[model samples]
Target: MRLRDLAELVRAPAALSVPGDTVAGAAAGGGPGRSTPGLAAASVCLYWGGMAANDWADREVDARERPRRPIPSGRVRPSHALLTAAGLTAAGVGLAALAGGRRALAVAVPLAGAVWAYDVRAKNTAAGPATMAACRGLDVLLGASGGRMRQAVPAALTVAAHTYTVTVLSRREVEGATPALPLTTLAGTVAVAAAAARKGPGALLAAWYAAGYGLAQARAAADPSPERLRAAVGAGITDLPTLQAALAARAGFPAYATAVALAAPLGRRLARKVSPT
Candidate 1:
């Protein structure tokens, strides 16, 4: 496949928004330190794997609804996408094992399974959002694999809740939505922000994260149209790193928090060229 096609298929720019998943998890589990890089890389690999598998599973529907998607548009073959997913999943698990031994694999293995399951079997069902949220929570738990899983619980739940809200909003990306949904989600975001703010000096970052995420959703709350909802979904995806950073900050890793938070603007800028959703 061509370079641009590969990038599009994997949603490369969006990967920037995912690494913080592990970072936050690790921090919450008891400071990421050296394990951060490997865990983050593993998370990104699984995330890309999920994206590829999603396209492969939804190729037919995408051909009708998203004709320009790599698989639907014929820019990339179905086999290639499936292979990509497999390779990435294996690599992700391997990396997790390398970083944290079997402890990490315990979480990584289930996470990989959840990703594939969501893309192939759950995306259109009532279980879709919950499944996706579970995958995200597992991603966080993967980082805490070799550490205290209990410590990461709060951060994991927060991220999962955000993922749930976003997944719910995504269901109506092409159909538009009622203000009630966005408003409800906005309230949830407030709760997430409040939870994140209780940790440490990281409360400041959480406050900013809340503002950015809330403002984006507020627009959707006001308009509730397909276009607006789509924008809101994109914003929610891009803003994830900021929340991750707040989680990290709460865990007493201000530097890591800053690093993750810094990726948000870049993710947003790149989204202009490549849709994160």
Candidate 2:
């Protein structure tokens, strides 16, 4: 497969959102350490794996609803996508093990399982959003493997809440959503912003996230069109780094938080070339 096609298959630009989860976790767990980068890399691998697995699982449906997707468009084969998913997942687990030893493995193994389960079983069920949320929550915890796990819980929950809202919105990306759907997600976004905000730079980042992501949701609520819903979903994916930055700032890491927030604009620009949703 061509490199560009592989990038599309894995939603590579969206992987920019993955590292911050680990950074937020590390901050909340008592600040980042040497293992932070390894854990972050592992998170990105798992995210890419999950995206590939998602496309592999949805290949048939995508052929009908999204024929231009890499797999459905014949730019990527289903077997190649599945292999990519497996390889990336294995690499993620290996990286986690090498970095944090047993501590990281505790979260990584389950996170990997959750990713596969979401693609193979839970994605179409009522539990889809919650399952995906759990995966994201676990990813945050993975960074806390070498630190105090209890302190990271709130941050993990904050990220999970955001993931839940995004997943709910993503469901209607192809089919238009009801006004109530965007309204509900909008409320969730407000609550997430409140949860992440605190006295400092984090608060500003939280407001930024709420404003950018919330406006898209609001527009979708007003129109509830497929196009609007897709935009909202894209905004959710790209704006995630801001939320992570807010959480990191709340955890007392302004510099790291700023670094994390920088990914937001970069993700948006990259999304123009490779859709995050």
Candidate 3:
């Protein structure tokens, strides 16, 4: 398979949102350490793996509803996608272990399991959104491996809340949603932003996140069309770094928070080339 096909198979651009989970966790736990980058990389691997596994599990469905997807388009074989998912998951866990020892492994293992379970078992079930949210929450804890795990709980929950909203919106990407759906997610978005704001520069960043992402949700609520819902989902994915940045700032890392927020625009630009959704 070509490199581009592999990229598409994993929804590569979407991985931009993964590292910030670790960053927020690190900041909240005890500020970033040398192992933070490795942990972040591990999180990205798991995210990409989840995306690949999701496609593998949805191959049959995609053939009917999303034929242009890499697997359904025949640009990527299902077996290859499955193998890629397995390999990346292993790599993520291994990297976590290497970077933070057993402490990180404890979180990474379950996080990986949750990712696989969501893709293969829970994705079509009513538990899908919560399962996916748990995966992201575990990712934040993974970054707190060598730090105070308890201190990271708030940040983890914050990220999980945002993930829940995104996951809810994602379900309606193919089919149009009701106004109530976007309205619900919009409420979740508001709660998440409020939870992350705290006191500091983070408040401004949280507001920025709410404005950008909330606007998209509001637009979707107005239209309740499949296209609008998909756009809202994409915005949620790309705008996530802003929320992460807010969490980082709240944890007392304004400079690092600014650095993380920069990813938001870059994610948006890349999404234009490779859809984050």
Candidate 4:
């Protein structure tokens, strides 16, 4: 998978660079002495689960337009998906502890487990969008200090941002004619506003970069040209995580925010490569 695609999976909006805004210069890297590898793994597991659910939703289209994928390419076994997803979830927790603090691992693994189960099961029902947003929000919670408003802000943003992305996919599901565009826009607005309102420079940096990141993601998603998508993915690579750390968060926020920013476009690139353009 392309680096952009992996970035997207991480869904770290701040990772991307916007043409005009300054990221607050917050500290870089995870705080010292906090490495809950289990939380990190949970994050990956949760993301893959979301991807799997999305794959299920687009099976037919993928079969037709993109047959080289694991499912369509005859490489994936439907019977094994369940077991694989489960194993990944367990491994995710283990990894999260390795990357995040113990507290992050403790809170994240269980929450991720719950989210993954829902994605595989109940998430397809009417509750799909809600569950999806909640799962993302849960990740922020796991990453945060205490679900305090400062920490909760990212969780709330995840709900809106991811909801918007999913709505874009839903429109694809319906074969055109957008679904919940208004709701998605509104949610995104609230998320942006909320993130902007946070007092510290860190939140502001997150918000500044987030604004551009959201726009770019939406632009990439709405674009119809497969060629254009491919090109844009290439363009997206210009702002990889290292540059993001060195530049975007230059003034106010930490460099890790740059890593977060790298997640979205990179994730998109990876998704396109694996799922098909």
In candidate 2, the residue pairs with backbone N, CA or C atoms under 3 Å apart (3 or more residues apart, or in different chains) clash, namely: none
Q: Tell me how many residue pairs clash in candidate 2.
A: 0
Candidate 4, residues 1-277: lDDT per residue as tens digits?
3454333323323223221111211121123124323344456565565455444444566689756545565555444444455565666666656655575577656666556656556555666656655655555455442223253443334333544344334433323333244335435544543534444544554454445434444554465344433333333232223223332233234545545555545645554444322
Worst lDDT 10-window in candidate 2: 169-178
Off by over 4 Å in 4: 1-32, 36-38, 53-68, 97-106, 145-174, 178-194, 197-253, 263-272, 275-277
Among all windows of 10 consecutive residues in model 4, the one with the lowest summed lDDT is 19-28
lDDT of 1 by residue, 17-133 (tens): 888888888888887767668988998999999999999998998999889999989899999999999999999999988888888988999999999999999989999999999
Name the better of 3 and 4 by lDDT. Answer: 3
| Candidate 2 residue spans exceeding 4 A from truth | none
Query: Once model 4 is optimally superposed onto the true structure by TM-score, how far is the C-alpha of residue 199 displaced, in angstroms?
Result: 8.5
Provide the RMSD of all predictions against the true structure, rounded to 1 decimal: 1.2, 0.6, 0.7, 7.4
Candidate 3 per-residue lDDT, tens place, 113-218, comes to 9999999999989999999999999999998887999999999999999999999999988989789999999999999999998776999999999999999999
Off by over 4 Å in 3: none
Q: How much is the lDDT of residue 67 in candidate 2? A: 99
**Distance (Å) between predicted and true CA of 71, model 1?**
0.9
Backbone clashes under 3 angstroms, per model: 0, 0, 0, 50
Q: Count steric clashes of candidate 1.
A: 0
Candidate lDDT scores, in order, read: 0.89, 0.96, 0.93, 0.44
Q: Of the candidates numbered 2 and 4, which has the greater TM-score value?
A: 2
Provide the global lDDT of candidate 4 against the true structure: 0.44
